[model samples]
Target chain A: MIDRTMTPLLEVRNLQTHFFTDQGIIRAVNGISYDLHEGETLGIVGESGCGKSISAFSILRLIPNPPGKIVNGEVIFEGTDLLQLSDREMCAVRGNKIAMIFQEPMTSLNPVLTIGHQVMEPMVLHQKIGKKQAIQESIQLLSKVQLSEPEARMNSFPHQLSGGMRQRVMIAMGMSCKPKLIIADEPTTALDVTIQAQLLELMKGLTRDIGTALILITHNLGIVARYADRVLVMYAGRIVEKATAKKLYSSPSHPYTIGLLASVPRLDQDLKKSLSPIEGQPPDLLNLPKGCAFHPRCRYRIPKCFTQSPELEQISDNHEKACWVDVH
Target chain B: MKSFIINRIAYALLILFFVTILVFSLARLLPGDPIQAAAMFNADLSNQEIVSELRARYGLDKPIYIQYVIWLKDFIQGDWGTSLGSGEDVLEMFFRRLPITLELFAGSVFWSLIIGLPLGVISAVKRNSWLDAILTTTSIFGVSIPVFWEGIILIYLFAVIFPILPPSGYVPFAESPIDNILSVILPTFVMGTHGAGLFARYVRSSLLEVLGQDYIRTARAKGLREKSILLVHAAKPAMIPVVTIIGLAWGYVVSGSFLVEYMFAIPGLGRMGVDAVFARDFPVIQATLVMVTVNILLVNLAVDLLYGYLDPRVRVRGNLGQ
Candidate 1:
């Protein structure tokens, strides 16, 4: 039998993804590493354009052509290096083993086809099932995602469905093949809070039932609080901190993480005090600073913090932080 | 649905009425008298006799409105009296020529769609490759080269140079469908090339836009093949714009261009329109313009109906309207 620690479901030693634009080579996903447990939900949190989504896309190799490139990275999943896989081989791994749902449901869903066809497409490709059987499974998936009148919905096109229904359909499709990992990239951002809660709850239950791991990528700390087992905080393409959901919320080590948690409206926060925002915009990925990327924006930046870069090192048995600050 | 049809048909009728009025008035406004043009060929009647006979024959002695009513009444009954120039029944002659123009459009559109869609999808999926480059270049050629120029070139090379395909003529579909096809094929392709290029390029761009959408990424992430990602996910919505282009192209092919028929020397209405304009045959010109206008409006209505079927929001809104 394989050693449990050695055979983690996913492991990335030093992944680095860069983008070659006309302006300059932008390191969208700078070197970072994390391991995913088979059954646990790993929430990847970062503000927009911090390479949170790009990191996930690089794992799937779904980044668009020309400008976006995974210059150096090893997205190790299930004991295989995905970056080494050929286009044909990567395609096989993409839909069956790992799946991703994008942010916008309205544009994400194909306009012309019925949701049924889009859902069954993966089944048709990977399972080698006939059209009729694929369609039946599609109906079942629609209902599984909590859509009512699933059978009638089979004939209806994407525009016929509402935003929430479409997002559910997206979830159902991602779950169709029972993939080992599902990347939900801001799955609920386009939606309001109530719908976001419902979708999160649905995803949690479905993932649990199927024994599938989930990579819930979102900016909202509140979401990861209840849903994720482990949380990886990213800022400017680098992992700033990694901890269990409870520890990350109650005891954030990185200043960025602290700012994020503090910024969230809380019952404990002073009523008279205005809400705190991240001090400044993210560092320009093209022209990165001399030392810590977050130095310009970091509230607790020391001389060492500006001149020296910090690596992610273990603080506790499971918790880790990448900041230079030595917090007890 | 009923309301849509009713509204469209009413609008078509209104447009058709204006076309008729414009054709009738404009034909009369042209300098030469139809009777004088007729007498020019007669060689027997004096100018005075020609004027009186034409006046009596057309009931031009009556008020212009009365003449219009009489003419419109006769036209509705499919008796357009006689050609002001040929003295032959206008309806009978139009009917004889009508099938030719319809066959040209029907044949060309069918070929264009069959060729355009695959070319478009392939170009979209295999973007920036040499194959796409060739298709893009060829489609550009198809779009830029005028139908008449292409027709002349094809005839010179294939018919004149190779002498394999028949030169140019019309065979009734009933007489021999094979000959009918041979007769219209060259002209049809020449006419269709631009539409094929236009449709394929537009459709490719549209499909590319949809393929880059989030759900498509989701489908890809789900491991759906690149082929299905395009065929199932991208092709359907991309076709909306394509449908509009096809409908408009069909109208232009039906009404605007007579060069194809003129080059091939086919006896189609487009050619007849040219002849009527030259000879100043008011009734024939009016009828032809109205027919083409009505056809275009009808096809646009069909496009809207197709949109309803493709998208349910339209259908639901349709129901709500009802």
Candidate 2:
């Protein structure tokens, strides 16, 4: 549905994803929802196994079957529900319209093919172009990603490239179609800090130039601060907080968000003091705690908070947070 | 790459040394006296004189080390001595059978790749479907049947029922390549089917695993069609293991698949080794065994190097034996 002034390019409403493992049914993404407007970066931040990546997989339907399932959701890109589309139709939408950059680069590339062929494949298949045209486009994409000697690199296999270069190739492929929404799930998590910064900056610049909506999913607060326009902080498969980058950094309401920000080593803080990591482990998705999932790990866990799960209540005109302990 | 070649050559010499000495000693020690072989080998010498000459000529009376050293030096330079049965040079005799063995090896390798790789990929991509079931059943039959038994059955059908396809014989490929191919097809098929069946299953499983990877996911997310994703992204990486198996099987086909040669009446190295053992021609048998070992070893070395070449991560620095 269209907003009054700015229609969101992608709107995921009441998404519920589950994993039926031997242990039990894990509610991976429990009733999470978000909106991405045109040319906006929506960053989903959470610790490992907190459904940040799972939610992105749900958008692409890349979740492996017989284990993971998107039980309920409407991934409305434009007006079409991606879940409802047939396999063929979904494929057309996948690279042509909505692209995703995965976490690992080494395992992501095909070992047997030249880098040129890997990039060219999507162009030829989706675009229905000739081999020459496909190759030309591939070279152009490689050059755009700053790969030197495009023709030579084209003949070289994935094994020939460095990790950073491979991630850049992944980014290049994601940008190949100039999709309306590019879901980059921990794209730079595997890279070194310096390369990570370079890739993030490149991605930001590229997306801005093309007006491509980005769903930047990660656990890094610094990355969120630098790249994201809005932030969704997930904990135990639910969005605990949602706000603009400025507001989320200044005044995070949820206790999990508060603990996470506190845990990060601040450059401004005393170097002599040891970092205080949050006291408890993340609540198991399979067997969650009663009432609020964060209760056992919280310092301000009220008795009533243990009896009821909190819904996302609007805290400000452009910010919302899910917590029983509301900021006055 | 240069280091790889040098390493292979050095190790190959060691392999030749041990294998030749083993075949030579074992052939000499077998129940029938090698004295009789020596006597049979010499037409001019008297029986008593032949026995004395044999001890001196073979250096059998001397320490085993002395015998091994004399043999190893000549063996390195392609001098396998002379055959007791034919009086032909062991090198020449081995070469005569080589054409046949190589032809069979080439045919089997070609057919296995042509059949196995595609079938395996199809089964994996269409896993659990009717086609997969059919391929699974067919490949199971292919693998379960022994090459010898399968060879005989094939002859019975093609040779007897059809009254056509020549059931047995060895013709040089150079003499008539077409005739050689035709004569050898049945034996090659029987042998190739085993590898084809094994490779197909490996390929399918390997492919499915690669297809499941996140890189493959990235390929699909590229909006490339399914064909390109399967061919370019999923197919090649999945094939690393399959290539490995095929490469290893080249060794097996060169050495282990002797029964195929026996059934088909081909004069390959396997057949020559068997014939040499029966005749108690120690030199011929030892020479053939060494040649087979060298061929198989070189094949394995090449494959190892190929693995490194294909994937940048796998570096073949030296030949460390298990």
Candidate 3:
């Protein structure tokens, strides 16, 4: 459990990541902000194309330029504003203090490189460790991720491993440097249901044991319910709702969040009830609505919801949601 | 692995057999009689009886099928027939000239690799920049210019204007290796420049594609330096397609050696092949075609093997017959 009364491990402030395309200026991560307490998992939930992945990329300053840029943001990690770090300093912080795992384990690893070489890379780069020692440590890390024959598996290529095993390798690599933060962007999306549960369990257990803060980005609400301590529900590149996981699950304040929860077919819910999926498509980032981006599709949208964009306002302690409509 | 090599070799042999038939038929397609061609050189022996004697001596009076059978039989026995023009044994003549062609081939390949790969990397890394534009523009010139014209330009610059090198001719590597290198240098450049341009284009495109792969992003995310990521992680897989281009270029350089050798006055297989074609020397022409086809097959096989080595995924998949 995280001690939220203490200062958060990471604090993102009013981050704005935009893409300057010939067609238009597309707002990808539009003024999103959240706090991640130490040793806690923060779930960033959104439908596809809702800037979930781009926000994670922006935190690391890994967004591609020319088209994509972090126009304005303060990603403060460990008391330093990461966005202000020099290239050299950022490089030092990237893999040593913070690491990330991507969704597609199938393609995340270099095909030509040996698994051991990849796992050992960060140790050598950031830790300044010797190759032999790094390999030894990497083998142990592989085993820690529950991979059998870690020594032999070290020499194997990414293609040789099963999807589940490859995801395990990714976890091992992410944990190699024992970084303080790990941003997993849809890590279990590529795995089947069984493997997904197993991989998530392995990752959660490891992070807990190491006392590392994690930011799990996924579209799966069920995963958030199972793993996250706090949740940030994003819609149209903004944090529409933020609350402790239990509070958010019990009383989701945002209509979008309510729609999200309703979309999932709960096993405990009445057998006769049907899942009600959100009706409209995600808004185009380049051409959002005049006021509230979600107002067009929002089932509880009042006339005010169409004319005015709602800012996140605190309705209760540690709970906030953006909504113009008044709901009992 | 053993079985794979054997399978490739078996397939090559089958192709070689078909190629021999094709070349044998095609070489005879030219509108000239070998007997009459041989007779033209000895105009004094214009009598019908002498002509018939010469025809009989060369087995020119036989049916096409019978002639092919005899040639195949002799070829299998390592007995290439006498050349129509020189009366030299075809095998002996080709063997005598083989070293020159091999030197040119080796030198051109070496030069292309040395010049092509680094330029390609630079072009791809600095894509759309001035450096990339310069390299791309020069490579286009390299590709567009014919090898013989490039050879002529080299001659005019080095031999005529600068007098820095011998414009043409070959030196046997066994005799004075330094002199041989100097003599072959100009022709090698002419031959290699075009190939280098080709290589640069192929390498640039393939490298660009590989650099865009998700693994490359992972490499960057790992905090590995840009240099290490490009060279270590990206270079090998990118080389797969470039390796294929090199293999195909190897075959082309060998067969296309005719103009290059002719322009340089080098006594190589290409020159011999052209002379054989002009003189209607059936045996020599067929033999050279066979050699060229075999070289092509062998080079492609080497490429396939190299591909397996560079990407272990391919090797494992191939081994599993998947």
Candidate 4:
């Protein structure tokens, strides 16, 4: 809603994240890149272990060391490469300029701490605010998240709250600092289906009201379709398709994107038609494939698809796909 | 909260009852009769006369059940029997030495916590580093070395080698606080090293497990300082198990370090208990056992209360609706 024509707020350039295990190196996020405009909601849709979460963690430098490392990447946030910033500088950015909410709300909160103390933690740490003022603000934050009886609930421990309420508390914590960007890694993945829709809607409305950009990493295409302004379809640690949410859904170019869309059951579509699940498991990151990683599972594979990899190429205005075939 | 505590207290009482019976049976189970052990020193008295006199004085001629009942009645009414060896009131002897044992226990636990908790935290946070490696090796050595050998080694260093402190004997703190500490310092070191080593290993493992939890990552995500994250976020839950081990070790500490006490000649409960055991002092042995069992029970109860305080989930699990 605000300043859509300005330069991008975040630009991730040729990111390469690898995991060194006993067996061999796993190219988790291999040569992936993207951009996010101010107040843009970018949905990263992929199957499990497709590197969606790792890429987001890479942006924040949250990857566990020794086994995992961002070998090559330039995560430019507001003209500064986040990768180049010192850990102290990054600390100032994390939970201040950029905040992240995790998938499992039940396990993500500290069991020993009261809701008030936890929610007030960031304000006290980053803003240098007194505990009294932080608690008062935390009550307001809890109310903003629609938690009932914010004052009484503030004294309650995480175990006392329901799953949905814990998630709402997590959202309130993420929004407390009014950060420029918020990363939600499958925020509603652990919630009930009905509660899932409610949380997604709540997150969308809050991000909009606060004018904060959101990176929603999820496997649910329906969630992305409903909330994302732009979508990136990832397969085996690579973005094979990128476009506006409507364009990507209506005229999906990549075979993987098409397969993903076909697999989703639609209420508006013909009822008799069975959903077509994509065959074959996601390729192992350690051994991948000789050329194109998706060629082994692609039904439209030609001989060239096995020996040669395809780079993301523009096929239409603001739409890109990494496929040689003209599916359109 | 009230119910849990009340239940714990009830459980402690039950344990105390069992301990009393166990100690009573244990005294009987030992080789040779208490009368025969006492008679060895009085060779002038005939065997028949000594046996009959001791049997009449200790009520040993009665049935075992009646004897236990008599002892329990006397115990409850503050009429603890006299020691066969010294002919003094066993309760009075124990109480006279109780202050020394209590002081040693408090000093050892205080030093252990002061030494162990921080080392444990540092080892966990800097896991795999040289500091962790060195601390781990130190803990292993501390645990493996015999307490007597450690006491002797410490005496050799501070008392013999340096000659700045005395090697043996305890001085009451009331007499001179500095001299009292100087005399017991070697024994205290032996006890503290054993406890600190144990606590360091436990705390390290617990902290490592807690550091890997999702909440720790959340604390980091919230931009909490590393110190705050370690102390407030990671330490509290980790301390639950550490508290348990420390609580259990409280029995060992308070019951008195027998080897350390004997080596240093401290007039503590452990030394008194061992001497009573050798001399077949039934009343003194029974009283010491009961006191040690009570100490263990109280320590366990404190740990449970501390567990509730550290992790509120334990207290709120049943009353979630409230």
Candidate 5:
């Protein structure tokens, strides 16, 4: 239900991130572009090392320097290019306009600091509110995340809490500033199955309630189907496919996307039928295959796929695929 | 918390008991006999009968276990006995020199923390920079250099060449604060340089490790200023290991750096302990050993309590009686 005519909440144009290691340059997130509408939930799906996390990191410019750098990109959030902003100006945008929830919730929160202080920090920093007011807001945020005993829990350190509770605290912290957009990078990957469902539902509900746009990075296609409005399937360092969640699930275009769907075990399918996992390992970023990064692993690769990379081309309304061969 | 403290105290007492026994045995095991050494100073004590009589008087003629029991009994009742060499009360001499040793220990700890902590933090924050290289190299030199040599070099530079501070000596702080400070500066500096190096290395590594933690990224993602992130969020966790190092170092200094004390000619417990060893003064040696052992034990206890205060994980475990 994205209005194509409306201005996008976030627009990432030709973003590229590379790592300069002693061995060689690692092209982590190759040139990629995407747009997110206001209040939309976009899921970036990929196996490990596909640069889904790196892509999200690039949008926020959180890539660690020395080894990692966003070489080229325009992360236009709310019509302003974030990459061009000064460090001071950038600080204002982070956690204020765009907040992020990290993968490891247990280690994401400071071990020594109390939960209240951590949750209250962004509010005090961005909102310029008093500690007394920040504390009250923090308690409310904790409660909103469905954490029990929010008032008493405020004084407790992170180690005292379970992984699920810590993730809830992280959610509370992410929502503390009432940011315009939230990037949850595999937020529930570390939790139990039930907890993951509950947390994601809570996150989707909360973000939707607040009319905040979300970009959920995960390898779970089922999660994307359940929560995301739009989906981007990444392979190697590039997005191999992008489409609406329903359209992508019902009619996946790219060979990599097709393979990914086949790999995941479907409850509706017969139990005796085995999953068909994609063949071969992800290409080394230092020395990728001299064509499409996914070509070597793509079962539907043609001669042209071996010689040349395929650019993301539109096939129909709201559906794009980067592949030489037509899967369907 | 109460149980944890009580548990630690019980452990400390057991350690103290073993220390007393060890010191008593080692003092007896020394090459020279206290009575014979006393006899050398007094011509009348050349008589064999007189030597035996003196040994009997000091209860040295009794079996080792009985002697230990008698000494322990007297020690517990506040009777430390007279020094074999000086004939002065062991406790009296200890009390008289305790203040000077404590002052030196305090001065060294203060200077080391002041010099080491900031340097270490700066080194880690500016890692791979020219400043980090220089600070790291300087700390290496601090750690490697001998304390006695450092003391002498400091004396030659500040005392002999510049004549800014006194070369060696102890002046009661009550007599003149300025002179007292000037007199101890070189000794404290010599002692603290090593500790400063150790602390700098520990803090740099610890802080660097902490900076790489996920929470640090979370802090950055939270829009916190770099200063607040480094000082507030990262510093406390980093200081946990540093606190343990500081505690062990404090115990070492409190026990007295004998070489530093001797080279500086300071009338401190370290000097007394060395002199007592050479003269085989059993009472003074025993008393000094007891004092040092207790100081180390107490510092260790404080460190454990501090661990509980700094790390909630430890505190929670303590509460759970784990």
Candidate 6:
């Protein structure tokens, strides 16, 4: 449940991240803005190439430079403009205030280092704690993540752990400092379906208990349905639709959002009716289609949708959509 | 770990066995007859009867297989045979020079690591910068310049022009450690130059690949300092490939850099090996090749063990096999 009266925990204003390649300049996250309230789970839904992951990366300033750069953005976290902080100051805020869980749990953990060492590192680094205390805390964190034999598991390398187990270790590391926010980028995408459910439940339970805000970035609508309180549907680097979980599922106004919801097979839907998937590919970021980027695949495209791109406008209380023609 | 070491040692022994056969065959295949070469050294042994007697005494008249068996037996028994040129026991001569060669080899490796590793790390971290360009260019020169020419240039600069270090000589470390180091410094540098360049190129490329890995990003996200991310998280895996190169380089150095030893007048195994070749001293040549082959096998074994240590995946596999 979100309280609208208090200041949001994190505010991103017109964030634009681009990649300058030999081919062209890719507008990865083009002028995306959003607010993440305290103790809320916000799901960013998009296809592979859309700006879901990039936007999350931009908020933390983790975009690799030379090719990828945050050209314009104001990421204000806890009354401080993060983009304006010095590198040292920003580092002090990173693991202590906001921790990240990457997608590939297998590759995300260092192969040479022990699981205990990796989990305990953030505590020692940001908390400035002694090794013995960090080790003690890490064992508890491991067990809290429901890993078996937490004591022995600490000395084991990443290669020794299963994917589910490794992701749990990542969660433990993310929750090590008890940060205010955790950005889990496709955290369970690489795991089995059963493991995915268990992990998601674990993450939800943990965040709720600690009151940590979570930004769950995933392409899976089902995951968003089960977890997120508010959802932002992204299409070609812009937020096409934003609404609470219930409203977006009930009355998805944007054609792209409507197409996305229709594509997933619902348990209540007719067994014989095949899903109607969105037609055409996502527009290339390098050379996007003029006007609405989704216009090519959008079913309810008017002539105005062809010449002029639509900005995200409020449709009703707690609901917004970027579309020229209203689907009533 | 114990089983892994034993397996490696067994494999090394097999390679050593083959190397013995190769060295024994190759040494005898040389053009000159050992007895004739021996006669040239001894003016009194000009007649055919005496030459035949000398051949019989040295077992040169026996069938090749029997000769090999005898040589192998004698080598196993630590009787390395007398040097044709110096008439000294080959094993004793080797022992006398082993310390000098070991010092030179050690110093070269030390200098190469000191010069190459940091430069390589810096170059990779500061990629496309002026410092990287300068270091890369210097490495290029190090790799390309001829060793003899570099040795000569160093000699001319330090010994002749400046007259700082002795031009060409060997000082026993026991007599004077300071003079011993001063004398070998130029030789070691000359020997290490190519290795330094090689290591720099290797470490830079290896580290670059490692820095791009997902784990490095995770390390950065954990808010680890850039130094810790590069040195602690990335360096171990990056060094896996670099260690192989170092092992090969060490084998090369240990076998002796003939040109470096000769130019510097350091009485090392390489100098002995080259002198043996000129004199057609079959026993010394055979001994040197066998020693080098063993050294290379031992180094390769150590490299494999070190590789397993650095990468846990490899260690796990090794353990699983046991």
Which residue segments of model 5 deviate by more than 4 Å?
A: B254-256, B319-322
* lDDT (Cα, tens digit) per residue for candidate 1, span B1-322: 7886787678778878887777677777899767777777777655686679767877867877787778788888887767777777878888888888888888788778877878888898888799999998888887899777788889998898898788788788899989888888898888888878887898889888877777678777777677767766666667778888887887786454488888888888898888988887877777777677777878877888887876556765664223
Q: Which stretches of candidate 3 lie over 4 Å from their true place?
A: B319-322
Chain B TM-score of candidate 2 stands at 0.88
- Per-residue error (Å), model 2, residue A268: 5.0
Candidate 1 stretches greater than 4 Å from native: A1-6, A129-140, B129-134, B319-322
The 0-to-1 C-alpha lDDT of every candidate, in the order given, reads: 0.83, 0.82, 0.88, 0.88, 0.90, 0.91
The DockQ of predicted model 5 stands at: 0.76
- A1-328: candidate 5 lDDT, tens digit per residue: 5576899999999999999999998888999999999999999999999999999988777888867998998999888999999888888888988999999998999988999999999999999999999999999999999999999999999999999999999999999888999999999999999999999999999998898999999999999999999999998889999999999999999988998899999999998999999898878878899888888888787888878999999989999999888898
Residue pairs in clash, model 3 = none
Q: Score residue B151 of candidate 6 by CA lDDT.
A: 90
Candidate 1: give the TM-score of chain A.
0.96
lDDT of 3 at A64: 74
Q: In model 1, what is the error at residue B13, expressed in angstroms? A: 1.9
Cα lDDT of model 2 by residue, A1-328, tens digit:
1232677788899999999999999999999988889888989999999999989989888887758899998989898888898878888888778888889988788766678777876667678899998888888888888887887888877777889999998888888878888999899989999999989999998988888989999999989988899999999899999999998989888888888888898898898898778888988899999898989988888898788999998999678988888653
Q: What is the lDDT of residue A68 in candidate 2?
A: 88
Query: What is chain B's TM-score across the candidates, in the order shown?
Result: 0.92, 0.88, 0.95, 0.94, 0.96, 0.96
Flag clash pairs in model 5.
none
Please give the clash total of every predicted structure, in order.
3, 2, 0, 0, 0, 0
What is the CA-based DockQ of model 3? 0.70
Per-model TM values vs. the true structure? 0.93, 0.86, 0.96, 0.97, 0.98, 0.98
